[model samples]
Target: MGIIDAHHHVWDLSVRDQDWITGPQLAPLRRDFPLSDLEPQARAASVDRTILVQTITVPEETPELLALAAESDLVAGVVGWIDLTASDVAEKLGRLRALPGGEWLRGIRHQVQGEPDPWWLTRPEVLRGLRTVADAELVYEVVALPHQLPAAVSAARHLPELTFVLDHLGKPPIVSGQLKPWSAAVRELASQPNTVCKLSGMVTEADWHEWTVDALRPYADTVLDAFGPQRLMFGSDWPVCTLAAGYAEVVDATGVLLAGLSPDEQAAVWTDTAERVYGADRPNQCRIRRVSPRGDASLD
Candidate 1:
């Protein structure tokens, strides 16, 4: 079956500075990373489809991403950004859906990790916005820190109709190797039937220069035990992961981490789960390359 990269990002520097790339450490991503730059790598990895996630919170970016999805062969779905707190959020979502190529708008995300308040997601207004998102049948991507996971769990509990995808496995503290609080909180969020977690961005969370598959295994296993393969999906996190490992290397490491699972479970992480979560069954624009059970290394 063809693999699906459930999450990744693209940004054009000329359009607007990704201001978050301010620090010297993020210098590698200062240059423009257009979809053209990612296509070859994605194709090389046998990734037939990808869900393009939002990078910045600006309103214009979503439409631009939707348009890009309409043009690109690789991107099958888009998790764009929206002002979730807006009073007319439902109407705004309708307007977005009416935009060119807007049908690919499968989900919405915000940079909740940067929010100073851990309870921001559980706030009254945000919950209202999430209700609108659910009514429109769009998923809400939870880009939150470990401390903010409780609010995510509460929000999910409040609005069970809205599917919540926890980005970066709630960003466990791999570099520090501390897992307890994060693991427990993550399990709480996973306990919600409407929630899912991405097995992405772990490499960057570990020591950028010196991370091993062994170093990430415990955190990965934590989520595997908590959410199971069906509720977990694969994501490359692409350019962000480039800060630590290359796309193929990330895929390879994931393969090693999941080697203990049966072929069917491995398939869920690599293909089936993403397809099911992101609704990627729509007619795809990209040329697909199938991978047999023995050919999994091609993704690595």
Candidate 2:
């Protein structure tokens, strides 16, 4: 079975600044982090293919990611960003899919966590754009914070046709070690059959300097219980996760968290869920092959 990393990111600082990396706490991500820098670590962790996600809300970024996916065997798909509020969003999505590596454009995302309004996702214009996304057969990745989850739930309920992939378990408050509202909200979102979640970004959300797998277990278990293995998938969160743990640490930590599940259930987290959700099993994917260093077994 192939290991499909459902979420990760790459950026070229020299080409354009990731304005979000401003504070001293985020200084480590200041340098250029292209796919070349990530490939080695991903290979070491046995990750064969990845979904290159959007970092900024800029439209141009999507085309670049799509082009990168077309050229790189490791990047099977891209979750690009678009202006959902634009009147011509459907036309713009069509234009993006018509680009060089258009087929690799699998989904669309916005930094909903950055939005001040909790109900932003439920706006009429946004719902209209989401319909366009669904009409094009692309999923919409929900990048919201815990407080914004109710709106996410409402949006999911309103647009049941759109498959909403929840990123980072709605950015749960793990460091605080409380799970009241977050747990209830998560269950509500998961109740919608169109929703799924990625088990990623937990390390960074915890106390970056002192997070332990034990501290993250509760949140992971909550989502697993709510979404189940079939709707849950593994995501490295890559360069962002570097702020707390390296690629291998994140992978190993996920293994520890999922150790209690049966092998078939674990397989869904490691591979099957992502492939089925993102349609990565499609024939057009490049399917990069890498041999585990311990032996010559190829993950082809």
Model 2, 106-143: lDDT tens digits are 88999999999999999999999998887777888998
Misplaced by over 4 Å in model 2 are: 283-300
Candidate 1 lDDT for residue 272: 82
Cα lDDT of candidate 1 equals 0.85
What is the per-residue lDDT of model 1 for residues 151-206, given as tens digits with 9 covering 90 to 100?
99999889977778899999999999999899999999888777878999999999
> For candidate 2, what is the total of clashing residue pairs?
0
In TM-score terms, candidate 1 sits at: 0.93
For model 2, the run of ten residues with the poorest summed lDDT: 288-297
Q: RMSD in angstroms, all models? A: 5.9, 6.5
Give the distance in Å from residue 170's predicted Cα in candidate 1 to where it truly belongs: 0.5
